[model samples]
Target: MFLTLVLVVGVILVWFLVIGGVCSWVWSRLIACSSSWASPYECGFIASSPKFDSFSFTYLSLLVFFVVFDLEISLLLNLPERVVGFSSFYYYFLFLVVLSLGFLSEFFWGYVRWGY
Candidate 1:
């Protein structure tokens, strides 16, 4: 047991030493100092700054609808081969009811509009 433990520790130590040595050598030889460069790259053109727009209500609603339907589909796909109980029917009915409610709510709230 002692021999095995020493062997494992020695192997791990050597592994770490090799990895650290390689990483340090690569860093020293290949990496350029950011201060020596004008930009992130050698290009002269300044790239446009990234646009950071907040998600609109329509986009948020669509995202929520996608997630809800995706979850429902995944659950349905894993259903038992033979559903033989009132519980499954009850759950499925409830799910459909919830989906219908969501659809109606989105329609009434103008989240389903595509005339933008």
Candidate 2:
């Protein structure tokens, strides 16, 4: 118990130190700079007006689709180790079903559009 407590305290201390250092660095960079710091040259773009006219739903849809597909790939890759004690045939069947569902959803949603 003592060892575990020491380890946990060590971890907490390390994380606290890291966060404190980062906060100090950011504070110094943002506060102790000249007038040029407020300008757009420091990775900050100044605009006279709003940049976006209207939000496009397609971008959000594409982002959601990407996240879904990425998560599916991660889950699929980790399945073998997770289901090692289960029947292999069941695993393959479930994989096929998931893949088919993804393909059908993409096709039905017009996500597979072809253009020049």
Candidate 3:
């Protein structure tokens, strides 16, 4: 028990020391570097024009939707085996059915047309 306690204390002390040192180093570096880092063209790169065209909202919305659904599918895939029984299989089947229906609707609406 004493050995375990000493080991835990030692680990905690080491972790805090390392984290504090890193934080101090990063803070000092940021403070010292900010004065010379504000200009956009500081690294020998010259800006030719003021600005270019902006991104479309449709593309951003589609990207967000893709990310949300991708993360949901990943989480569903990693569910515990004990919790994923026959009901989970049925749930997955229902999800796939809904997804397919949405895809078909989008296809019909020309939202998923091939090529730009």
Query: Clashes in model 1: which pairs?
Result: none
- lDDT, ranked from best to worst: 1, 3, 2
**What lDDT score goes with residue 48 in model 1?**
73
Q: Provide backbone clash counts, one per model.
A: 0, 0, 0
- lDDT by residue for model 2 over 46-98, one digit each (tens)? 65645776667667767777887786687668666774666665765687698
Ranking of all predicted structures according to TM-score, beginning with the best and ending with the worst: 1, 2, 3
What TM-score would each prediction reach against the true structure? Answer: 0.57, 0.49, 0.48
Positional deviation of residue 33's Cα in model 1 after best superposition, in angstroms: 7.4
Estimate every model's Cα lDDT from 0 to 1. 0.79, 0.75, 0.76
- lDDT by residue (tens digit), candidate 1, 33-74: 545464734655444755546878878877988898998888
Q: Considering every candidate listed, which one attains the maximal lDDT?
A: 1
Best by TM-score, which number? 1
**Decoy 3 TM-score against native:** 0.48
Ranking 1 against 2 by TM-score, winner? 1
Stretch of 10 with least lDDT, candidate 2: 41-50
lDDT of 3 by residue, 26-89 (tens): 9888787685565658866556745647777568758866985896688577666546468677
